[model samples]
Target: MDLTPESNQDDEAVGDLSFDPKGALDAGDGAVLTRLARAVEAVDPVPDDLVERSLFAITLAGLEADLMEAVYLDTPLAGVRGAAAAARADDTAPAEAKTITFTHDSLTVMISLSPAAGGRVRIDGWAAPAAGLDVELHRPGVDVVTVASDEDGRFAFDSVERGRASLVVRRTDGGGGAVSTPVIEL
Candidate 1:
C-alpha cells in the first residue's frame, strides 16, 4: 500500500494524524520566549553605542591575532640594589621599581622598570635566545612608544609615564606575528 498522499482527500485526511503546527511551536514554550523577547526589547532596547562596540569587538576577535599571556614572576625591585638604604632615604619617596617577565614558546622577555629623570619611568628589557627584535610599549592615554632591540637583544624606553602599560615583541624583519604581554601597572 502506497502511503504517500496523492489526492486532496488523502492530504485532508493526513491532517487528522496528530499534526498541530501551533501546538508544535508551543511545545517548548517558544511562543512565550518570543513574547518575552519582544516585551523586553520594547521596554529597553539595546544601546546603539554598545552594539557598535560589540560589533567592533567581534570584528577584532575574528582577526588572526596571536596573543601571548605574560606571567608575573616575583622578583626584587630592578633599580633598587640597596633596598635598606632606599627605604631609609625618604618616607615620602615613590614606590620601588618593578621587574616583569614574559615567556612564550619562542622567546622570553624580561624588563625592569625604574624611575627616570623628570618624573618618568624607564623601561629596560632583554630578550633571551638573543636576537634583535622590535619592542613596543603601550601606555594608557599616550601614543604607543616603540624601540628596537640591539644585537644583544636588549631594548630600552626612557621617560615613560607611570601607569598601566604593556609590551609587544616582534621580529625586526616583521616576519613573525607579534606577541604581547599582559597589562601591568607601572
Candidate 2:
C-alpha cells in the first residue's frame, strides 16, 4: 500500500488540521476540552480532603519543629500513624480504642483516643519528664487548640472532631524547642 496521503480515500494530510495556541477556543474546542476533563475525572478522581491535606503539609513544613517518630501503637495496626489511619476507615471493624506514642530526644508523649460525648474524640495525653508544656491540637480544616499540661505532665482535650490531626508540643519555660507528631487520622 502507498504511504502517501494521496493513497487514501479522503486524502487529508495530517498537517491539514490547525490549532492556534494563543487564540480563543471555539465551541467545538471547548466541548473537546470538557470531554477530556470528564474523562480524566472518571479515570482518576481527586480526594475530598486534598486541599486540606496540602495546606496541612505546608503548615507543618514551615513550623520548624522536630518531627517526633511514632514509637508505640496499641491498635491492631503494626506500623505508625499511616497504618493506624488506614485501619480506622472500616466502620464494620470493632470499636477498639487507640493509643499512639511518639518521642523526640528525651521527651516522650503518649495520647489515647476514645469516643467523646458528641460523636467527637477525647484526647488524653501524657508527657514524661513532666514539665510545664503547651500542647496544640492541629486539624486540617479547623483552628488550632492549645492547652497547658498540669504539674503531672497530663493534659486532655474534652472533644475534637474526627479527621486528620496532629499534636505540637513545646516547653512552657522556653527551654527545649518544639516537637510535633506525625499526622494521624482520628
**Most TM-score-accurate candidate:** 2
For residues 74-106, write the lDDT of model 2, one tens digit per residue.
Answer: 556444444435445654444446788898897
Per-residue lDDT of 5 in model 2: 57
Q: What TM-score against the true fold does each predicted structure earn?
A: 0.54, 0.63
**Per-residue alpha-carbon lDDT of model 1 for 4-24, expressed as tens digits?**
576645555556655563355
Q: Which candidate achieves the best lDDT against the true structure?
A: 2
List residue ranges in candidate 1 displaced over 4 A. 1-65, 75-91
Alpha-carbon shift of residue 11 in model 1 (angstroms):
55
Q: lDDT values of the candidates?
A: 0.66, 0.79
Question: How many angstroms is residue 53 displaced in model 1 relative to the true structure, after the best TM-score fit?
Answer: 17
